[model samples]
Target: MNASAPQQSNSTPLCYSINSPPFTYNHPIASAYYSSIFTLLGLPSNLIAFIVLIKSFKEARSRSRSFFLIFLGGLVVTDFMGLLVTGCITVSFHITHFNWRNLDPHCHFCNFMGMSMVFYGLCPLMLGAAMAVERFTGINCPFTRTSSQTKGRPISMVLLVWFTAGCVALLPLMGVGGYHIQKPGSWCFFLISYKGNDQIFSLIFSVVGLTSIAVSFLLNTVSVVTLIRVCCGQDRTQRRRDHEVEMMVQLILIMVIASICWCPLLIFIAQTVLSEADLQVRYLLLWLRFATWNQILDPWVYILFRRSVLRRISPRSDWSRSSIMTLYPTLRETIRRLTSSSLELGEMDEMGKSNVTAPPTLKP
Candidate 1:
């Protein structure tokens, strides 16, 4: 006989004599079922959020409107990515009975999908941190007093957030610890595989995820607390102050809800990476997946449904103070000397002799 035949005979005897672990379909079924539910919930919510963000951007003028629209845009995009990628994996697991060995195509897809999801997932959290910083600075140094303008800052901050998130998500592809295809079917997530020195990978992933989450949490907490203190202490005699307080409260509610939805997922992700045993692993994974669905849902339910929260001003429609001067004749002549328009001076000189008279010129 050939050398291969003897080796095959020897391995076959051992393989037949060995007892393999039971293949449980329960984990795959549960994940698939719930993942479908999450997908259904997420798709519609993200669509609504996308619509609302578009509307808000079109009508936005104030700094608050601009900031909120940016945050909403990032939220909707990332959540949609999560729903698409995660939802597919869930369905595949159910259909194949979680057989990782036979799905090479899925393995490749899962790696890419997981990488994209992780990157996009970080967008909203980073945006939340940026929003908190913006609000805090706005409150502590009102635009009227602060000579420095924020006209370009929000966009710049958003770009930076996405860039950083992208860099973090790419680490896994570079062999720096990220999701990898697990055996028996379906991809496994967490920093380390159970087979090798996965603990080191887990440690790195946990540290990074936790650090980002903690920073976001702390920033948002401080922002809400500071806003509450200022609003509560401000004099109620001013109707404008009361209105401002109401707006601040609404903003805080949105931030708090976002944080609450995301915090659990972050905690569980860290727990999974840090824990060695399979204790509650499947359950925690399920719950974390469910919690992630909130990233899609919150923007739709909280921000989109409450469209009235956006300021009523339209940037293109509203007349500037300069436009107001041009629209009315009497007001135009009164401020003609304050302007550099020769046409306005000529008009003022002619109006000086007319029934419509300018106000008496005052000394500087």
Candidate 2:
């Protein structure tokens, strides 16, 4: 009876331990499910968006709009590559369950993946913020705009964002930060538990992500309001609407979906660093899952929020600007006002014809 007691305890060690089941991608069936979901959700949407972007680019009339389409093209490319690159590595890891220390003795693989995760994650948020700024300038600051809206500027800015993300992603390799195999160990990212450099790195990632979201929200709100005013104004001279309103609708949806899916992870990163709290493995996994949703849903913002889609769904749309129904209901009222104005114009012309005063002048 005394010898019956087992030498090993039933309780499992912490998830931080290398090669531990809790820390590694040990479940094959679950990994397969994850791989399928990401592939199906992210791949087609991005490809379709790419095709649509090319056609739209050719159709773009204004210089600013052409630049904006270029930005959208860059975003589509980022999302497509982000999905392809990260998905391949993740699926391979889960399928193989390779030992990180054995497979990557020099930590090169770990570091590269860590950097890729950060680079891809930051790019979309940064791009969203950049698009918002471009739209705001096109709407509110068109006359005062500088040379930044030049043909090369949009492409240059895209490259700059990619370069900046790459630099930050490499900071861990430069000793400013570090990356570790995070839970289910297939992926590498910043872990908040480490004290000096890792903590700083986590804070930096969080700050940059949060700031991009903030800037996007502010600028997008202002731009949307400006567009709403133009579409709703009583001034008859303001009949010509900004064709960029449809693009603005897409931008707003992208920002909103991104904020919804990413804010939790970004906030979690900040809280874990600040509090030095016990790592909540479940919470981290949950938030990480949330972040992936942004990639899956982002391309659809462009695909679905178009003027063509709006016209197909609505009862009728004589006004192009009426397609902004994805963001606000106030635009429905504007559509009614425009339709009413057309009827009123017809009635006013008839009244003018009836009030002809030819007989009065002859009698005098």
lDDT of 2 by residue, 238-312 (tens): 635546777787888899989999999999989988998877776877787788888889888888877767668
Encode model 1's per-residue lDDT on 1-364: one tens digit a residue.
Answer: 1113323556421111221112443556355566667777787788777886798688876666566566657667777877777677766676756444334322345456656666666676666667666666666556543435555667788788889888776665554544544322344453433334345545554465556556656765676575555533323342223333333454555556655765666666556556655536465566566457566556655453342543333333324332322334675565554444656777888887696767899889
In candidate 2, the residue pairs with backbone N, CA or C atoms under 3 Å apart (3 or more residues apart, or in different chains) clash, namely none
Off by over 4 Å in 1: 1-23, 28-31, 92-107, 143-152, 182-188, 191-197, 233-251, 269-280, 304-364
Pick the TM-score winner: 2
RMSD of each: 13.6, 9.0
TM-score of structure candidate 1 = 0.65
Candidate 1 residue 62 C-alpha distance from true site, Å: 0.9
Output the TM-score of candidate 2.
0.80
Give the lowest summed-lDDT range of ten residues in model 1: 13-22
